[model samples]
Target: MNTEVIWTFLSTQGADFALKVLGALAAWVVGRWLIGIVVALIGRALEAGKRVDATLIQYLKSIISVLLTLVLVLAILDIFGVHTTSFAALFAGAGLAIGAAWSGMLGNFAAGVFLQVLRPYKVGDFISAAGVTGTVKELGLFATTIVTPDNVLTVVGNNKVIADTIQNYSAEPYRRVDCVAKVANSVDAQDAIARLRPAIAAIPNVRTTPAPDIEILQFTPEGPLLCVRPYTHTDHYWQVYFDTHKAIVATFGAAGYPVPETPVAHRMVAAG
Candidate 1:
């Protein structure tokens, strides 16, 4: 090409190219500032929710920032006359592959969100879930940490817990502690019942509203099983269980009733 033709092309097209580059740069600067503002607003809104947990708020902020950035990048690419629909398809394919690979992790994340929203069991609540019974120490995004009854720390996946039963002992205000005391069938039934019921009621921490029940259960191999049931606050369940049994032994001993020398399985709860 001749020098004049080259000069003419540069003067027209080069100036337009430089203006477009400047415009894209300006858009980038404004877009980044807008993203920051939007992210801050979103964080404040989430904080205002009060129910939204801190961990979840942070995760949402990250997601919003990434989405806004992707949109901004696409806008800039459009300004430069580049194809963006192909990028969207590429991202969709990549996302599908990642989702398939991390399906378990995704399930855990969704379960965590549901847990926070539902508030089924909170920290310090005693819960039995997925065959592990313990006090819930912590609930995380993917798993839960519980201190077992034996004082061992157990981390269970969130997905596994909801998949099974969740029994919240702390949900109720009161719990019943049933203790069975079996003596010889020869013992006086009415007298034993009369002595046992009052003795159980007198124990401290036992609730008086429900009174107390001392009924003669069906005769067992050992003897007549007296079902001593007492009510107490849920927190004092274990304490009441132990103390009432002691009261039973003392009550029967003072009355000169024959007490077994060996450890008897008198504390068995009936399976429903």
Candidate 2:
């Protein structure tokens, strides 16, 4: 081919390539802005629902925006005569490998959705699950945040928690607290029970409607084993339990009840 002819062809092709590049860039910018507007509208709709968490809504909106933008980019590439089928196949192959590697993560994501839908637990609720007890801080797509009684932050996988039994202490408005107290076998069981009722009732946050009760659980070799059952508001259960225990000990001591002790035989007479 002649040099002049080659140069003329190259110039025309360069101008065409530049036009396509500009068009693709313009399409991408417009597409992104459109996606943003749609996502904002979706967020507003979710907010209007007033039943969903605002943070969750915003997260969903961002996810949707990214997906929409991806689709627009693929469309723009196709408009520029770029083949995307090969890209789709590559993505599918990669997705399969990723799915296998992240099977546990997928389970957690599914469990998180189940938890949200079922509403098994909520923020600020004290729950024991997967062998850990703490107050719920936040429920996320893969993990749940819990704050321990000592104020330590614990991140638990949602799948593990869902797989295990969940004990929600604050599920109900009231809770029953059981405490054990030992008294001397010489002390009258009936008298001990009577003393517990009045002492427990005097503690603040101890519910009187259901009434507290003390039962002789067993007769140990050392002394009588008593169990006290008191009902209190869920929030006050721990407070009442501690206070009632203190009150019972004080009342028993003041009343001169013999403290329970293990028996020790000082001497054994031998049979001759």
Candidate 3:
């Protein structure tokens, strides 16, 4: 085009376009800051109520953040003269395509909603779900965060979690710590049980109401496998478990019990 035409276009449309670009950037920054504040306020309000579960609180916070962010994007688009009605139609079409692509994410989101309603497990609960055994860190809209025993942070889809069997260890007041002790075949089983009863009970955090159960579980080639089960709170399960083993060793060693050995068979061919 001619220089005069180019100069006019740059002076009018170019400046307006630059202004719109700057406005969009400013809106995005301010909108994000406002969204964060709103999400945080809602979270604080929910926590102050003291009635909502923490897991549910986190899920709600995530949902609110996403929705508010979407609103912010629409507002910024409006600044660029993109009509909200047009954007809505575009969004609806995009939603259909995105939903088809991220069907699993939508499934996880639905499962998370159901999980909040059903109240199967909550934050800080140790549970085994979807083959993951760990303490629940957070329940997000799309996934559940778990910190495993080995201290690994894992994120599993909520759909997988809800579809699988969940064992909530923290659901009950107490749980059994399973341990086994092998006694020599010649050792009197009754005496071993008698010695273990008090020793296992002496361990810290072991529940006294049900008492510890020490009994012959089964016989193996080595000896009679004594099941040493101690009941304790889930928080102290590992402590009691390890201490029970130590107690068994200390009691048996002090009593001079023979070590159980697997009898190996030897064949002789007469030197043929």
Candidate 4:
């Protein structure tokens, strides 16, 4: 090739390459800035809508921003003469492989989606599932986080939670606490219940409207077993249970009522 021809070709190609690079860079920068602005606007709008949870709104906005940014990046690459079709195909293949490898996780993800949509439980609510009772700390894409009464953090798989029966204690504003007290067979069950009524009602957090009830459950060899059922505010269940128990014991003791003791039965074999 002649020197003049080579120089002319190099000059033309170099300018074109520089312009393309600049255009790609500019597109990326602009796209990133636009995504940021949109995300910020979404967050503000969600905050203004007090009906929705702010944390959930923020997470949704973040996801949208990420997806939009990815699309913009691919578009910029395509504009710079990069073949994106093969890249997209590769991405799809990888996604399929991952899905196959983690089928259980995909199921959990689906369950999580259902849970979010149905709004069965929210953060800070008390729920019982899979024999574990705790306050919900977070709801994630694949698991639900809970903090137990002992301050232990538990992570429950979304799929397992969905598949199992769930008991939401915080769903209602009030709850009833049921307690069983065993009195001596000699003690009058009805009198024992009457004595407990005043004290149970006086306990803090115990509801007055429903009125507590005491029933003689069964007659054991030791004494009469009684059941005490009291209605209380949901938040005061534990407090009422413990307080009522102590009050019942003290009241029975002060009344001079004899508490039945468990008697041991001894079988005597006659000498043969």
lDDT of each: 0.86, 0.85, 0.90, 0.84
lDDT of 1 at 181: 88
Estimate candidate 3's alpha-carbon lDDT, on a 0 to 1 scale.
Answer: 0.90
RMSD of 1: 5.6
Model 1, TM vs. native = 0.81
Residue-level error in angstroms, candidate 1, position 88: 1.6
lDDT per residue as tens, model 1, 208-256: 9888888887776556788899999877888899999899898888888
Q: Give lDDT tens digits, candidate 4, residues 9-126.
A: 7787878877888999999899999999999988787678554455567667978998898789889888779999998898899989999999999899788867876778988888
Candidate closer to the true structure by lDDT (higher is better), 2 or 4? 2
lDDT of 2: 0.85
Which of the two, 1 or 3, has more lDDT?
3
Query: For candidate 3, lDDT tens digit of each residue in 62-173?
Result: 9899989989888888988888997788889999999999999899988987776677898899999999999999977678899999999999999999999999999999
lDDT of 2 by residue, 134-238 (tens): 899998878999998889999999999999999999998888899988888789888988978888888898888788877998888768899998899878877
Which of 2 and 3 is the better model by TM-score? 2
TM-score for predicted model 2 compared with the true structure: 0.73
- Rank by lDDT, highest first: 3, 1, 2, 4
| TM-score of each candidate structure, all chains considered together | 0.81, 0.73, 0.67, 0.70
- At residue 57, candidate 2 shows an lDDT of 76
